[model samples]
Target: MAERLADWKQSLDVALFATRMNFRSHLVHPGEVVLANLGALVQAVSGAAVFMLALSTTGVVHGWTLAQWAVLTGFTTVARALWNTVFFGTLDIPDMVRSGELDHYLVRPANPLMLILFSKVDTDVWVEIVIGLGMMGVALQASGAEVGAAVLLFIPVALVGSALVFAAMHLAVTSLSFWLRYDAMLSMLVWRFDSFAQLPMSFYPKWVVAVFSTVVPFAFVGYYPCLYILGKTDSPFVWAFPLAGPLLLIPAVLLWRRGIARYSSTGS
Candidate 1:
């Protein structure tokens, strides 16, 4: 047990060191970083504007008031931003596999997936984090939602779980590259499906809800967690959403291991 704990700590240190190196490398090109952040700022503003415009026209969506919808949207944005900031490297797996770049990761002492998935940081995504937090503040004020100790504690838990869910889905999809030789289409498809998660699951038809909650499990990432925060759900099952992150990770890790076992370098 001590040996395993020590190994885990070493892996964590390696991941953190790599992340720091990635940031320092980006700092060498400060101008490009600023420009990229500016572009991200525009996108964030546009997204928030779209939600505002929709609420202005309709005043309500499904049974949710504008404020409630804002909370949902805010939660979605924050979850997505966190995922992209931390695990954006997972999206590069297909390209790396296709180009034989993954060969470099295979020989490392640390876990290959850990090295590959956490080696890079998207510094520009800090803009999204800032904008997301601002939106959440506004939504919280507008909705006048009661905050209990449980809700406070669960906020970080939900965010971490939501990001992990996305990471798991991305890893599962990208691992297909090992056999299929191309996973870009499937990756894009999964990402497109996530757009549905921006809204409350209550608005969806029964079948859609079942599909997302079970087959995809995207609802646990943002929808169900937000419902719990909004005091709209009291089901004991909802408490399981945070654990869904590690549970979902199991299949992803298994598939990744299988992929690695089957891997053959392109001999570049």
Candidate 2:
């Protein structure tokens, strides 16, 4: 038992070390880092200016003061930025599989999925996160919202939940590599999903909301949690809804594991 415990701890340490290494490698990649930062800056400036202009035209947003809208938009922007930075390659699984590079990944000591997910970091996305927080702050001030301890407590839970949702969704798409000869279709579909994700869920039809929320689980990306932060929903569900984002991983990871096993058997 002691030996087994030691082995487990050693593995955990290695995994943590690998994660740090992955982050360090990203910092060293000057070209990718610069491009990412530039993209992020553009997104942030464009989003903020557009929102300000739209709100100014109406003189108030849908029951949300200008500040409140900024908060929601801020969360949305930061969430997308973080996901793109960390898991940008999830969409490339199909290509990886087709090129037979996935075979190499499977032989590595660490988890293939983790390696794939953390391998890339576009530092430019940080711009979006920064701008997003700025927007949220503007919203908070406009809405006159108080920062109670309870609300602050929910922030991390919500953030982590958002990350999980991202991983789960990306994994799900990548798993198709096991079955499809090409993932061009999946890539196109997931990118389109991004635009849908950007829109406020309330603006969509009820069925559209249902499809993305329960079926695809993208709503958890921003809408549901943002609603809770806005005090738009008080259901105990809101407190726990963020948790639902990561829950998307259960099936996605399981499917990926199963697909990998089949791939191993086929040697393809």
Candidate 3:
């Protein structure tokens, strides 16, 4: 048993080492990193600017102050970072599957899924972290909701939950590549679904809210937990939302594994 545990630990270390090496290789291509960073910066800045403009026009919408609203925006931006970092293969899965690239991935010494997912780190995504946190700080000031150390305690939990939701959503989307040969429309569909996550779930109809909150649960990563942080929802559900994102991932992953089994390699 001890040998088995050691083997597992060694495998984990090798995975981590390989990931570090992949990141280092990208760093050598400074131009690509610069271009990617620029794009991410533009995305983060545009998002924050638009949210700030909306908040200014409304002053306070649905009892949420600008700071509170900004916190929601930050949460969504963080979700973007999580999505790109952990589940980006969703966008690339179809291409890999159709090109017989998946065969190579399957034969790799490391876990093929982990290697494919985390091998390419998006360096520019840090821009979102900077912009989002800056907006969150401004929102905190505007809302006069000085978060205590206790609030910081919830941050790690929220981050983990957000990651789980990202993985679940992206993996589910990518799993369709197993059977769907033409996936050119998949990216557009993902973007459309993600657009709903960018805004407060409260502004939508109750049924829409129910769809996201209970069915898909994207709300747990950004909207619902932020509502609690902003003191908007006093419901017990908000307090339990952080766990929802992670719990939902179990079924999603199982489905993804099943899909993998069904994957028929495209000889091309």
Candidate 4:
């Protein structure tokens, strides 16, 4: 247990250092960061506007009031922002493999997966975070949900779980590049599936819900957690929803290791 603890600490330290280095690189071009973040903010605002416009006409979507939908949207946005900030670079894994850049990562003493995962940081994620929090606040006010201690504690857990679920999904998909060699279509498909999280699960057909909830389990990332916090769900299993992210990592990591073993450099 002590050895495992120490290894975990070391990995955390390496991840922190990588994050700092990426942040410093972003800081070197402050104007670029600001402009990029502004673009993200605009996109988020536009999405919120569209939701609001639709709600104005119907006042509810699949039994969820506008406020409830806002909460779902906020959670989804924040979870996705966390994933993008940490793991968006993984989307480039196929290109890296194709160009043999992954060989440098493999030769590093630190865990190559961690090195590649944290090598790039999207500073624009701050925009989504800010907007997401703002939306959550609005939802809470409109929903009149009590901000209790348990809910407060659970929020962080849910966010971490959501991030893990997203990261694991990305890892599993991108790792396929190791075998497929060049195509990014699978990764792009999984990435686009994130859109499912922005709306209420009830809005979808039963089959769609089954696919996203059981097959992909993206619903646990934001929907279920939001329901738990909002007191809309009574399932005892809701308490364990956070584990879904880390638990999914077991298979994802195994697949990634298999992919690594099969990787052959492009010799670029």
Estimate every model's Cα lDDT from 0 to 1. 0.84, 0.73, 0.73, 0.86
lDDT of 4 by residue, 138-229 (tens): 89789877878888888889998999999888888888888885458888898888888877888888998899888888888888899888
Q: Which segments of model 4 are wrong by more than 4 Å?
A: 1-15
**Residue 154 in candidate 2, Cα distance off native in Å:** 1.1
Residue range 71-189, candidate 3, lDDT tens digits = 88777777677677756655677778878888876766655666666666667778877787777767766787657775677766776787678677767667677767676477457
The TM-score measured for candidate 2 stands at 0.85
Q: Give the TM-score of candidate 3.
A: 0.88
For model 1, how big is the CA root-mean-square deviation? 1.6
Q: Model 2: per-residue lDDT, tens digit, 1-268? A: 9977776565555556766777788778678878867876886798688868887777554455666667767776677767786678677788777777877666766677767766654556767778877777777767777767877788667877776787788778778878877665876677677756555677678999899888787788777887777777678878877777667889988988888888843355
* RMSD of each predicted structure: 1.6, 3.0, 2.4, 2.0
Q: Candidate 3: where is the Cα deviation over 4 Å?
A: 1-11, 234-237
TM-score of 1: 0.94
* TM-score per model over all chains: 0.94, 0.85, 0.88, 0.92
How many pairs collide in each candidate, listed in order? Answer: 0, 3, 1, 0
Question: In candidate 2, residue 153 scores what lDDT?
Answer: 80
